[model samples]
Target: MTTALVTGPTSGLGRQFAIQLAAAGHDLILVSRDETRLTELSMELSESYGTDSEIIPTDLSDRDQLAVVEARLADP
Candidate 1:
């Protein structure tokens, strides 16, 4: 299975990306600062498409958190 890392998924293009990717059978790793919105999106995508979605609450402008996200992607 292919996995996609989509940032800013709480709204706009990011949200659309998540929905489209899930529809295309991709497991999603969603990153956004809004925890509530992220959780809501996760549930909606999971229910609508039967696809697994993981949410990481983060502010991308923060260097530290960005590093954390990079590390997660680097994991085997």
Candidate 2:
């Protein structure tokens, strides 16, 4: 299945992107500082669109945390 990796997914533009991507049938990897919100969004998306979602809780400003996302993106 195809996946969309969305940063800041609990708020603002990223949240909108996550919703739309799920509706379009993409699985998700949601990166956000707020674990609670990410969990809520993941469940909602799963129930609403039947899309799977994974949550990664980290502040993207941290270099180490950002590297995690980069590594995921590098995967084939």
Tell me the tens digit of each residue's lDDT in model 2 across 1-76.
8988898889889999999999999999999999999999999999999999989898899999989878877883
Question: Candidate 2, clashing residue pairs?
Answer: none
lDDT of 1 by residue, 1-76 (tens): 8999999888899889999999999999999999999999999999999999888999989999999999998993
Off by over 4 Å in 2: none
lDDT of 1 at 2: 92
Predicted structure with the largest TM-score when compared to the true one: 1
Error of 1 at 61 (Å): 0.5
lDDT for each candidate structure: 0.92, 0.93
How high is the lDDT of residue 21 in model 1? Answer: 97
Model 1 residue 16 CA deviation (Å) reads: 0.8
lDDT of 2 at 25: 97
